[model samples]
Target: MRKFILCSALVLVMTALSGAAVMAAKPVDNDGDGVTERSDCNDNNALIYPGAAEICTDGLDNNCDGLIDRADPTCTAGVCSDADGDGYGFPADPSCSYTQEDCNDTLASINPGASEVCDNGVDDNCDGLTDTADPACGTNPHASNTWQNYPLDCLSCHDQQFNEMADSTHYWWVGDTTEMANQNGTLQGKLTNSVNSYCINILGDWPVCGKCHVGRGKRPDDPQADKTNIDCLACHNEDYAMARTRLADGSMAPSLAGVENPTAEELQVLDGYTQNINAPTRKNCLKCHAFAGGGNAVKRGDLSMSGTDLHGATLLEGTDNNSDPNFDVHMNVMASDLKCQSCHVFQNHKTIGRGSDLRPTDDLARGSEVKCVTCHAGFDVDGGHAAAGANRTDADRHVSKVACQSCHIDHYAKVATELNRDWRYSHDGTPADGTNGPGHPELTIGEDLSPVYKFWNRLSDNYLLGDVAVIDPETGAYPTSRPIGDINDGKLYPFKYKTGVQPMVSSDSKLVALDTYEYLAGSGDVDQAVQSGLVNMGYPSTEPVEWVTTDTYQLLNHGIAPAANVDCAKCHGDLDLATFSELDNLGYALKGPKAQICSQCHREKNLKSDHPGMHNHVDKGVGMDCLFCHSFSRQEERGGISPCDSNATDFVDTNPFAHPECSQ
Candidate 1:
């Protein structure tokens, strides 16, 4: 019985040991996680298990999928935040699926799709470069600006400029017509009676024409217009001048409609431009002046966006290089670097200069003239034109009868200029898309043009609103504007001779001012534009209309080349006299028979071959009067010195062979 009981006890012990082994083999819920030690990558941590969410910031793979943290698709480590709502994000994470990075997270306009702006000191397009450094900006880029409340906001600190501009001709568009020969001492200007070959006149085009005016919207000459109507930003801000559009109430407002799909550089944030207001730069002045007469470099031949090199590039289209200093010595950055105000010289908003075609004397007291002597005080003195191996005394002598620009400006319209505008036809108004076909008033452009020389006394006989249009017998075209003076009283000047074909009153022989605004803004019919102009001028719309050729002489003052670059042969040499008839046309014709004139000095001479000898005699301080051969006289400029007397023994001995033909 004892042996049997011991065996039973051993069996019972073995059975209990077997039950403990089975319990140890079963899965255990460690840390309350359902996963066993084999399946859980980390059984000790409850958050870490198979199929668990990955904690990217914690640097742990909670899912236990072999990938760690951000390596797993479940992690949001590479995602980015787009703060500006530009559909672009900053801090681009390669692991995340999102848009490219934004260089400027604060600006919605600063995206990868944006275009680079020039000279704004910003990486506007989210490119690595800012402003001019970017190749996309080009050598010369148009300036831009943005404003919240332009003129009114400017009044907080610029009340003085506002008051001054309010009284200026740029604002009023009218002043004393001090230089108009026909309308002298009258209150007239572009606002009332002014006329030109380009666009005809501004009588019925104030809304469109006034875009260049400094006023907000009303006619500058309106009695009710005041300082409140002045557009201070037009001069102070370049972008404002470019993007300004007429409002429903007749005031001007900066609108994005001026440009299509404009980038942030073109249409920037408002505070930057408004708060950083500065004095007008060349960019500001050119915003209106350069774009006058509808397009760039179209109207004024001398004054163009490429007139200066201040920005180190040419503003002209298709011109990518820096402007040559020879284009304009005074305005060249490498030379004088002078601003328009440097010569125009404004004081209290009253400018000192006005073209002969223009009608206002902003500051009558300051004078309505701009002379080279104002800056070059002693340019006429000895050694003024002296070079290393050349003597230009002959040029110095001519200065008394020749304006400085006549010789200095070798060519006008360095950029293409509209020499003629025929309004007999019309087309679509879109010039930007190149789909306008023939364009309104088909333009005739001239580039690098030699100026037409004329005698001017700073007085102009400009055709007025109701004045009878007189035909120039020389040109066989109506003279809309002409310089007034004879060779006896005037100095030789360079001019841009422009012509146009416009409607005229057949009965009255008066030129009609076509409504260019209506032609451009409304129906593109030139005939309808003429009828609108006639009605605006208080004439019957059915008034007998005739197309006549009209011409105007616009003075060329800017783009003065260096004195050393002047080609003397253009006017002085025998070669020029043979080809050019302007000299003889301007009363420089021989006063009498060449043989008789030469006999008075010495003996009979070959008129053409002896030209140099006759000029050499005058250069030797002979005090010979120009009237001896030419119709005009410079005797007064000779300081009362008498002409060469062949009777004198000293004259005979010193000038025995004065005439080259006689010497042979």
Candidate 2:
């Protein structure tokens, strides 16, 4: 009985093992491709069986081998015709596995491996993108897009633009001083011959001050300069001004400070900036102009970053008053939105507009002056100044004697400007902290200040570099720069008055062009700066020197406020205050006794009472001549004043302020 039970147990165990083998051998095809899942390479796809046909263009392993569609031995690689013999074929086939396809079959240079030729309206490379649209092309919108060779690469296709800029005042920093009364009809400029109250002069300071120049490394007038010295990116790229740094060799180069070994992501960002090229915007221009005298809004009182739109908003975040459009109507983003070039209008790189204090006449033809008449036509006529509740006739007559800026630009330095710079004291802050010690001069800045009034006739007496310094008898200060005009031939204009303490050569009384760069880069000593300056000016270092107070009058031509918003009482009402005091000081007083002059026309009138009415009686009431009591004549403007009787010559007998019939 035991032997029979053992034999039955063995049979039962064998049956169970056989059943397990049968279950394992059952066919498993999840995709239902008629092949087992183990045999198929891609079981999720029905077309990926082991012996399936390889479809070359599918980019897939149609036949389940160890290879993709193009690499399959069974698939025939498709070919295209190479008509241009450039080795690259046309009619790009996805099935072609041997080589990259060309975009244009007719031209051999239009192959996939070729370099892009910019501005030619041709796809030089077979990347389906052309010229500036190609990633390989640099920022240049013309041929030779590489920035490697610098200005030479730019000149390859932009020769005309290059030549135009080469002759421009912006590049040379000097030009014909046709408007200067001191150096009229002579070549004068700020490069090496002009002196001002700001940094004083450019002599012996080219290495530091020349960073703002458009040239590469040398001075603008350097004999070693060539076309390669031009920096095209200075005006074209907004970020270039801040991105540049002075090298050990005294040349300016794009800063690669933190990216010596750039990663792929950082390289992409740099490439994007290299490809960004555009016309000069306010942001681009303000980079140098707004920060002229070492800091923001330090030199030009009217020009500031707040004049721009998006960029200005970012720069003036904490300063809300500066960002107001009422500060400047023309440059206001919410208003006219005019650019610097809009009024200064450049033709072939020769700009048309310049202030009286500026030395160069960039456009000698004087095709256009940046005048209010350019936009406000008929401003000299009677109804030109017409407003809702204001007496505009008197305002219009004042246009003959007052500049638009005098009334419209009531205030200047919306952003603080350097009103005075004292070299005797050192600045005690971050910008002055350096290895050379604190060398920056102490600055007296003013913000939202009233402009000083002056009479100007578009002529200037700017101080030349080597000329002997002379003190103005009236102001008791050395006039580094001044406007040239009087009440007779000049109109009232606004000006920014600046002062500075500088060294003067006691032997010759000449203003020394102190080496401010030395004070900034070496030991912070004003005396050392003066010593270096004297030697550079062809004088002995031991030349006797004296500290002198110098002053300059820079023309305020920008920041035009709205005409309707002007306060007429600011000038006419307060005869003893600001405007009249300034006007009387500058020789705008009556030619003779005011009471005696009024008696000739009628009963003696109160000169101060009804000032507007009195002006109307002399101007529109009887058409009296302006020269009867003033230094200048408005006869031409009033159409040859009311004809007076030829026999009545004496002022006491004839009413010169009345018409012919009224005089009788």
Candidate 3:
């Protein structure tokens, strides 16, 4: 009985052990391709068995050998194409796996080796995160990938922006005008054969002028054909000034046109361009604009190298009066924190404001007009101080007659502006001699200069390339740049009067672009520069070159002062003042011995003069004071009352006993 019981127990134990073995060694086909789970390395994939055909570089393990994609031996050497030169690979076949590391293969600068850019709404480096979310591009302009390849790198993220800029005036240097246009309908651009009082023409020295351009290398053979040649770092990098320090003196300078190619030392300066990139700043604008006429403050009198923070903290105080050291009223750092972009807003990459001299007004397109009316109101409402006066009825009259800038901006070129430049006397082409003087000896500067006022219609009969300048008979010079206006056309405006001498072909007295390679490249080779310029312009060097005096009236657009009431004495000098051309245009005829207008209002039958005192009875000893018919207070307080009109009587209060007879 004991032997039979022990045998049954042993049978049960053996049965349990056999069941455990079967569970551990089970072989079920998951994909059901005739291969069991124990035989297939990738049980879930039917095509990925151990003996399956190897398709290398597919970003997948087809043969299931633990090695996958590009790392597999099946991928032949040189199968990976680094199209963008960023050192990443992508499969040419659609059925194969996409390049494992590179998100975008078409762009040579965007790859795993590229640095991520932030806030541009693109996965620039393609590490998953985009824009602000990218850890590699934090609050600072830091890119972990230390690669720098110019437009290739920038275009990886700013494709749309680059395309938009290609259409802008900043890029083309020519566009349809919003204010005025020439009769030919062909718009002028700085690049498209237009010349200026400063740096007359860029035709002969494209590479040198291109240094200031927002592009890399040099100007392309054709601007429209190569739109992708943008340099994002030129305008966006705040550290460009610091980076420029790496360049050898006069080595990479734009004026040194002979040095077309950059040396190793000059190329090092480009590395600084890759740092501290952000939006455009005043510094970026001044980089070219402030130094326009070849050196600091050479072009526009209103600009200088003294730094925008000339007044420092005093500008922001806004407590200054006439007695204080005058500062730039509008661009004062402390006053308003105004930057160049504040007023020249951009739309679709086209800036709102146009250059007064660069573009003609008659051909202007209109919508982008940058005027004072866009920001400030002309009249007062409710309790606010009226700009023109109370009710603005009288002050509003001047709105059509006078520009806001006429009374607001007192002067321009506060630091200094080039009053005249004689390139003939100073332009020897040898930079070391500086025959004229140090730092653009050709220029003569004038400090604290007042603007020349004129009545402008906003249209210009400007001279085009090769057009013979109309000589100013009286001045014996050429009016290369002038503003056109008449009493019926426009209102009074202010302008910077710039005069200089440039080359003109003597045969027909037409303008000619001189070879300025030495002036630009610092090579000091004038003969070669002239030869190159003549060749570029398709003009024969035999065409005798004559230096002609040229003048330009560039409009003043900045340096606005805080609003203050005008003194009555300013307009009404002697004889109660009424000798303004504005009054004559209004049909008043308030000039010498002309009493026709005064007799209409006054019962005095025979007033002899156009003087305001002749119309006032008190001045004539016949009746009351001048206040009876003239407003002596702020114009806004009296609701647009003219000093010589019946509206002035409206402000007479109960204390007006002296002029009661005339008031009634």
Candidate number that wins on TM-score, 1 or 2 = 2
Q: Each prediction's Cα lDDT score?
A: 0.69, 0.69, 0.55
Q: Lowest-lDDT window of 10 residues in candidate 3?
A: 313-322
Model 1 lDDT per residue over 157-248, tens place: 66997888878888877788777788699987778788888877887778788888877778866788777788776776666666677866
The TM-score leader among the candidates is 2
Per-residue C-alpha lDDT of model 2 across residues 547-599, encoded as one tens digit per residue: 89999998888777776778877776635421245556777555556665666
**Can you give the TM-score per candidate against the true fold?**
0.69, 0.71, 0.60
- By TM-score, how accurate is candidate 2? 0.71
lDDT of 2: 0.69
Against the true structure, candidate 1 reaches a TM-score of 0.69
Where does candidate 2 have its weakest 10-residue lDDT segment? 310-319
